[model samples]
Target: AQSVAQPEDQVNVAEGNPLTVKCTYSVSGNPYLFWYVQYPNRGLQFLLKYITGDNLVKGSYGFEAEFNKSQTSFHLKKPSALVSDSALYFCAVRDGDWGSSNTGKLIFGQGTTLQVKP
Candidate 1:
């Protein structure tokens, strides 16, 4: 089975400091990794993905992630945190072939709520 773990329930940071939200995944075969952000009463917004390439992948809102195959991890990072950046973060994974309508079910982690204090 495929799964993702977001070890942190919440992350608190002050505006202007670097921030990071950790994530790890497990899958039967090669996985399609994704990161998403959700605001209050809103749907998940795609952040970035690691299809296949350099270990580091960049995404929206100045966010980046490192894909470590050996460790089975893809941690999201940003150079600076903002109050507006405070929101719920989610790490998700799907099977390599999961994109097809037949298997487009995306399994998401519990989520990590970030509080960026001004």
Candidate 2:
């Protein structure tokens, strides 16, 4: 089984400062990691993904993440935080190696609320 953990319930950052939302995962085999953002009364929007290749993956809205296989971590980072960036961030993962019975479902972490204040 694969699972994602978002240790922080909320992350507070001032505008113009860098922000980070921590995420870690556990899986039986290689992992397909992804990040999504959700606004009030809105569905989750795709941010980035790490299928393979580069250790660092960039995504929408000036967001990026570093894939650290050694630590089983895929932490989301932004060089500068903005008030508009404040939203619920989610980290999701799925096992790369799936069996016939596997549904290829993604397990998401408890969402982390990013509060960017000016």
Candidate 3:
């Protein structure tokens, strides 16, 4: 079984400052990690993914994440924040080796609210 943890319920940052939303995961084998963002009344939008390759992955809206295998963590980062970036973020994971029967199943962490204030 795989699971994700988002320890922070909310992250507050001033506009133009760098922001980070923590995420960690556990899985039986190698993990397939992803990040998604959701607005007040919208569905989750895919941000980025780490299936393999580079330790650092970049995604939409100038967001990026670092994959640390040893620590089993994938933390989202942004060099600079924007007031428009304020939204709910989620970290999700699935076992890379899962068979077709388990397809489309993603374990997600509790949502984290990011507030960017000017």
Please write out the lDDT profile of model 2 over residues 2-103, one tens digit for every residue. 789999999999999999999999999989999999999999999999989999999999999999999999999999999999999999999988778878
TM-score of model number 2 = 0.96
Alpha-carbon local distance difference test for all models: 0.92, 0.97, 0.96
Model 1 bad stretches (over 4 Å): 97-102
- Candidate 2 Cα lDDT to native: 0.97
lDDT of each residue in 57-84, candidate 1, tens digit only:
9999999999999999999999999999
Expressed as tens digits, the lDDT of each residue in 1-118 for candidate 3 is: 6889999999999999999999999999889999999999999999999999999999999999999999999999999999999999999999988787767689999989999999
TM-score of each: 0.93, 0.96, 0.96
Stretches > 4 Å off in candidate 2: 99-102
Q: Relative to the unseen true structure, what is the C-alpha lDDT of residue 102 in candidate 1, on a scale of 0 to 100? A: 48
Off by over 4 Å in 3: 100-102
Question: Where is model 1 poorest over a 10-residue stretch in terms of lDDT?
Answer: 97-106
Decoy 1 TM-score against native? 0.93
